[model samples]
Target chain A: MPSYKLIYFDLPGLAEPIRLLFSYGKVPFIDQRITKEEWVTLKPTTPFGHLPILEIDGVPYSHSRAIFRYVGSIVGLIGKDPMENLAIDSVLGAMLDIREAIVKLRFCEDEAKKPELKKALEERYQRTYKKLEVDAGKNGGYLALNRPTWTDVLFCYNYELLRNALGIDVLTPYPNLQKVKKTVLSQEGIREYLKKRAPNPMKPKYELQQDL
Target chain B: MPSYKLIYFDLPGLAEPIRLLFSYGKVPFIDQRITKEEWVTLKPTTPFGHLPILEIDGVPYSHSRAIFRYVGSIVGLIGKDPMENLAIDSVLGAMLDIREAIVKLRFCEDEAKKPELKKALEERYQRTYKKLEVDAGKNGGYLALNRPTWTDVLFCYNYELLRNALGIDVLTPYPNLQKVKKTVLSQEGIREYLKKRAPNPMKPKYELQQDL
Candidate 1:
């Protein structure tokens, strides 16, 4: 197997799912986190000048979603075939719609205009979450194919980010997704990793550590 | 095999790549183009209330990128293994970064800020195009691999959309991508589909018919 090294900030932000996948599969890797100052110097070295890069045997692959899918595949979190992957990838893509909404709101500088952005974010989040809820229910608490796929990892990570960022308990209404969180956290590898993982300074409100 | 039906607007927009892939694969699909008036009634029934949906045996799957990947797989544009798919998917994802920049500028309705957005768009386009040029050169004129894949399909489609939308001929500077476009367009299936396809009203400046 090729040596895997993940480069990102100390915070979970984008790299967490990759790390979580490594742990979930018991794959050994170097989880290298750089400071913001270090990121400036290293950014140019990346293929697309972005963080959350996965370097395999010194070959770097950027684009978080692409990296997630790649890592998810290696860790066996991806589906067995194209059709199965489409189901997983489609759910992953749909969650991006929700993530995009939160990201749009994150860029708002005007304090007075935040309410409108938040409301729009809430509406989008709820609608997308409701769709995922139905899928999760169909899959028996898993996000896709009635098993734990990378979609579950992505969903849980994005859930906290979107929830804490939006300052709302959005998942309270969705029982199936909550079950997804439980299913993911129940993994032995993930549980051990989370217990030892450091608390996130950026999102002190909720981190993977909280699940442990 | 399941019967494939693509539902989208009368315009190409997000649905073009799906159509192009089907053409490339030589698969027959019901190209269901509904007008804006019809979309309202159809919207409520869609999974995410969006167009560019692929209904397989009447089971609807929305989200354009997800649909593209699913359709791409059926057409044999997807990679045979996880690693190869990663390369194809990463290239597609990188192209999306460029596509997003162009789309953002396109949606800027402020005439006063148009120049700034245009400049930023050009810079982004040039930088990303240069990177893709390098990849194309390495992969023997194909974006992801030496031979044609779904990455080529996505790049060519996004290239035209970004080009006509920005009113700029971005491909003239990159020989490799030009080769990529030619390779995709030269496929007998894609060529025949383009010839028979109607002109896009939204982008009156350019259409697939122009290449044909």
Candidate 2:
């Protein structure tokens, strides 16, 4: 296999899905976590000055979604057909929309505006989760298909972020989404990876390992 | 061949790239443009209540990027290898980032906040365009490859939006990006489609067809 090294912040923000993909496939990779200070010096050298860059065989590539899809392809976590992939990708896009809103709310400096942002985010997630819950239910506890795909793996990380980082049990209302989390965590490779993975420094109160 | 029907606003926002892909491949598809009034009734019927839904063989699919990639694959505009696709997808992701920022700036209701949002968008596009310029130069007037890909086609629409909707000649500083636009516009299928496509109702002042 080509040498793989994933570079990102220590947090399980965007890179966690990719890490899970590699671990699930039993593909060994160097998980290079960098500090903000180091990122300052290394920023200009990056393709888009973004984190969660995956270097494949010494060639670096950026964009977390792009990296996630690439790793997913390698790990056999992708769909069997174009339509199947499209179904998975659409869910991925929805998840990204939710993630972006959360990031915007988290980084907003205006304290008074936080409530509005939070409310907007809450509304968006509610609409999105309701739709996703239906999909998960129809797909037998998977996000896009009856079998677990990378999107389900991504949902697992997103679930962790919603609960631990945002301190909201967003999945409580969506039993199928909760089952998605369970189904993903139940994977032997994922369980093993979570058992050994480092606790997220940013949100230490609830680790994914505890759930596994 | 599967029957294709694309539903979106009359404006060439997210759906244009999918149209371009279908046009490039000489694929016949129903271009279903709906009014805001119609969308209000149709909203609840949609999977995610979003537009640019592509129905393949009567099966409706949402998410523009997902549809774009699916159409691109059919049109043979996708990269040849996994790594090559990664490169193209990275550029596409960057373009999405730019588009999202533009959308945010456009929708900002606060008069005082508009300037700040515009300035932030300006800084972001400048940084992003500079990086894209280098990629275009290396790829011989294409964003991610020596030959035009779906991203090059998307860039054509994005170029028009930057110039018309935003009223910014953002490509003037970047000769390579300008060349990329020229290269994409020169494609026979693209040229034909642009020549006959309806003028964007929102931005009638400048149309992509005028460039062709």
Candidate 3:
């Protein structure tokens, strides 16, 4: 196995799904968390000055979607065939879309437009969650393929941020997605990782620890 | 070979890359372009009420990225291995990021924020284009690999919109991306498609036909 080191800020923002994947695969990796001060010094040396750069055996790779797919493929969580991977990727793309919207809402400097953005975000999240609910219902509570894929982990992590950013338990209305969360958390390695994971100061209310 | 039908607006928008892929592979596909009047009645039948749905055989697949990857894979445009795929996907993700930023800029309702958004988008495009330039320079004029991948086609289509939306020829600064555009344009099937493809009303200034 290649040595792995994930460089990111302490929060579970874009890097958590990757960490979750490693844990689920029962693989050992160096989880290198950085501070904002350290990142200021480190940013110039990065390929794109972005976080969640996964160093696979020392070479750094950027972008969470690429990194997630890479790690997911290694852990047998991606998909076996192109068609299957297509379905998996579609769900991942949707989850990322939601994550991006929530990020935008959180960082909106325009106080006047914040409410409008928030309402738009809430509606988007509801539509997305509703669709996922049907998929989860059909796939035995997994996000794709009638079993757990990286998207399940992605959904669970993004749920944390979406819940905090929206100031609502975003998954409450969708029982199927809630079940999907339960299925993901029930995995032995993920459960162990969740139990031992460090507390994130940024999103305190909706911690994975709470799920554990 | 699977029979393909792409459903989207008459404008290039999201469906053009899929069309380019089919054209590049020398495959025939039904290009179902709809107007806004028809879309209202058709939207309810769509899986996610979104366009650019790829119907393979008869099953409709939603989401552009998913559709792109699936079509790319079938046409031998996706990378062969996990690491190779990481490279391809990184470029694809970057292109998507740029496209999303441009979309936001185009739809900005706040007049005061328009220039700020425009400047930021220009900077992002430059950064992305510079990175792609180096990669294309290294890979003998292709965006992701030495040979053409879906990203090369995606880059070409996005360059059209990004150029038109920003009201500037963005590729002039980066010769390798210009070369990348030339490489995509030189494909015989793509040349034919570009020659016959309808001009987009939204981006009337820039068209792929100019490349042909």
Candidate order, DockQ descending:
1, 2, 3
Worst 10 residues of 1 chain B by lDDT: B203-212
> Candidate 1 - CAPRI tier?
medium
lDDT by residue (tens digit), candidate 1, A20-106:
888888899999989999999997677777778888899888778888888898888888877788788888877888788787789
lDDT of 2 by residue, B1-212 (tens): 89999999888888998998898888899999999999999888888778989999888888898898888888888887767778888988888877877888888888999888888778767888999999899988989888878888888777776665468678889999999888777788888888889777775466667777
Ranking by lDDT: 3, 2, 1
lDDT digits (tens) for residues A39-145 of candidate 2 = 99988888877888999888889999899888888888887777888998898988887787788898999999999888877877888899999988998888888
Candidate 1 lDDT over B100-163, as tens digits, reads 7777778888889878887877777777788889989999989887788897988888888777
Residue-wise C-alpha lDDT for candidate 3, range B1-212, written one tens digit per residue: 87889999887778889999988888889999888999999887866667789898988788898889888888779998888899888888788878878888989999999899888888778887877788889999987778888888888888888888887888888988899899889889899999888767764787878877
Q: How do the residues A96-120 of candidate 3 rate in per-residue lDDT, one tens digit apiece?
A: 7787778778899989988988987
For residue B107, what is the lDDT in candidate 3? 92
**Winner of 1 and 3 under TM-score:** 1
The DockQ score of candidate 1 comes to 0.70
Tell me, by DockQ, which candidate is best: 1
> Model 3, residue A26: displacement in angstroms?
2.0
True lDDT of residue B128, candidate 3: 79
Residue ranges of candidate 2 with Cα displaced over 4 Å: A110-116, A165-168, B111-116, B165-168
* Displacement of the residue A137 alpha carbon in candidate 3, Å: 2.5
